[model samples]
Target: MQEAFSQTKNASAVKNNYDRVAWFYDPLSRIVFRNAQIQAQQALIPYIPEHANILIAGGGTGGILEAIADQYPAGLRITYVEISEKMIRKAEKRFTGKNTVTFVHSAIEDYAAKSHFDVVITAFLFDNFTQEKADRIFQKLDKLLQPDGKWLFTDFHIDKKSSRSWKTWLLKSMYLFFKFFSEVEASQLPDTTSLFKKAGYHAIFTAFWYRKFIHSSIYQKP
Candidate 1:
């Protein structure tokens, strides 16, 4: 409890820390999480609907968006929401001359769009928040989605039944390493399904890669 409060107290430092390192985030992330990204891409492939309006939250570097663009049918629309100016700049440069998408330079929690999205995808985003913050975000996301919309999410997961003591230690170590460079919460566990359920969505499909190294989950908003 004390430790968590200590970290939370330094939240501003965390935000500034990420802002400073956003420029180098993509390359470093790719090196450490390459296979996980590929798994997330594959899991998302089957969920793309023809001529649908899609929402991408915290879409850094736009790799997932580019992949979706290649597979999305013509006439499909995309809204890419990102918080970091550095990441937005990089995405703009990557997608130069392409007009198939709209970029929103704001956090998802602050974004208010009149149109309900057919699909809302979040890649490597929710892990940055504490449990309370995550709950608030999911509630907001529920309001953003259409009745028949689906939410797609991918993130790190702890290996199941792999010696709790060791896993706990390993989890702490990993969080420290990641937190040094990025804004990530150690308590942010694999929550794609729970977040969806609490937000009134029904889990439709899920995929696990490399023995819980990563998880991709799809939930339908019924």
Candidate 2:
């Protein structure tokens, strides 16, 4: 989750940024969010049907691969999409199960779908983008999902009602760190809940972790 990225036009910079931090991304995340990121992801895994086709976009360090593989030791295929070569290599060695996985080394924007996916997992992906980039990415992925497909989205959530709170300061500090470290474009998290609702994806389940700072939700394409 600590991996930073940018829009496609600046893919090289983002790739370099992610690669530079690939060694420390997971450790930094654990230091900051502890197990919240992991918990939020696992909360949505039960919704994935057996033999499902899954796409993991921006899969940092590929830690979740082990979890998904554990959930379905067989009868599952994963398309792991990432921009960083170093991260891809790390992810390649992370999976230790029977599920078939195909690693795609490309930005999500540059990723061409060979087949529609039954499940799309974009954990902590959107928080790195501005509203425009996030919307563009969302629209693209929205089209690649099969009907009745499940979209698992997990990211930081900040309440607009509370303009001045610890979460706001913490998020601001995080953005500053990411901006300095990875040239990330986002200064704040997007309004993800509204974005999903606008896309007409029906929410199947929602959960929060790390004191509600992190949100995980599964939506179905009707």
Candidate 3:
């Protein structure tokens, strides 16, 4: 994945776009998606072990870090990775004196993991890629997990059966907004559930927030 990300055509563009919005990301994100975001994080908290080695890929602005720290148990080693330097700096501010959390400023594809992590968290991260890229990236992420490890994922999903027309409009509007400001590669949400199943990951738990527009699930790697 590191190699693939290094070769990505829009890596720098994406990084720059996020950097441009780092200052406003926290506040805007809170106003727009805080409820669902918090709910998703809370759902995954119970699955994380006390002494686990965890990877937080594309954890923008460190909202997840703050949540984990509030209820964090001792002996857990967390490596938080974000591609935007400014975003990571904000995260760094939240954990100023904490030794258990290590921050890495790099794209997930370029990050070098010394060993497989017991748990991997990718909250609201996968929505930025196209289906094909998301599939490749998921494969790479799966390789970074321990054999029995679980992946805690949260992102937007547009369910045709369950979603209303207005919900679809809202999702599209949000995507267009991000695409202009963040250079988001995908104009629509990827079919993540299908990709996960194809990769041999089974959902151990799942939840929906905001009328099922936002989906959260924990998939275990076999």
Candidate 4:
């Protein structure tokens, strides 16, 4: 309790913003993106081994937890990390599966002494941090991954082919809304694909959603 509180007290505005919107976060996603969010998430489920040590960062409202539990009834050790206390509470209630899951209400950057895992999942997580913070978080999580582990990443992407598309404007508008309400750090999406590649990770699989604005990808260090 002390540890969680200490981390929370030192967190950025994103924590408070998520706490305020924890109730509507899940519903709002469904209303705007319908099943697309879940669909994109589900795309990476097959990549997880039946029995594996997994770390899911920024696992908002337990959507991914619910999905993983439905697929793996046992032999799964998961550490779920999130910054929002209210969001953590919501995730705790929604997780009813038999898998061994630990919910930690701390920013991924603050969580320490983690075991290396077979899989690391970060969905809709990278979109919240600026370049420098994103670098720190990525390096932190990257170190927590096993040499041969799979990195499951799902986030908004920007492609030159669609640089001028409606999704671009939509992305801008969403940032503005989140900045005002959540005060998230990043003003725009980062080129995460390049971020991974530059670190020597290889993209094993990738699937797109919401007209290619969103992507779910599996990467590995080969």
What lDDT does model 4 reach? 0.81
> Model 4: C-alpha RMSD to truth?
2.6
lDDT of each: 0.67, 0.83, 0.77, 0.81
Per-residue CA lDDT of model 4 for 1-222, tens digit only, reads 011223455444543247767789888998989889888998898889878999988888888878887787678888888888778877777654678877877878878745788999999999988888888888898889998899999998878887688988888888888877777878887667777988899888989999887899999965
- Displacement of residue 175 (Cα, Å) in model 4 is 0.6
Per-residue lDDT of candidate 2, residues 1-222 (tens digit): 113233345455652247767889989999999988998998888889998988999897888888887787788888888877778889888754778788877889788888999999999999988889888999999898999999998999888764788889988998888787777788888777777889899988988899889999999988
Which pairs of residues clash in candidate 4, taking residues 3 or more apart in a chain or in different chains? none
True-structure RMSD for candidate 3: 4.2
Quote the lDDT for 17 in model 2: 45
lDDT of 3 at 97: 31
lDDT of 1 by residue, 1-222 (tens): 000001123333434135556677767666866666656756775787877778888877667755665565356677777766567666766532232677776667777775889988887777777778777878887788889898888876665566475545655765776677665654546455676766677878888765566678888888
lDDT tens readout by residue for model 3, 10-65: 44455324887888877776697767777877788888877788999988888777
In model 1, how many backbone clashes occur? Answer: 0
Candidate order (lDDT): 2, 4, 3, 1
TM-scores across all candidates?
Answer: 0.80, 0.92, 0.88, 0.92
Task: Name the top lDDT candidate.
Answer: 2
When 2 and 4 are scored with lDDT, the better candidate is: 2
Q: Per-residue lDDT for 30 in model 3? A: 68
RMSD of each predicted structure: 7.4, 4.0, 4.2, 2.6
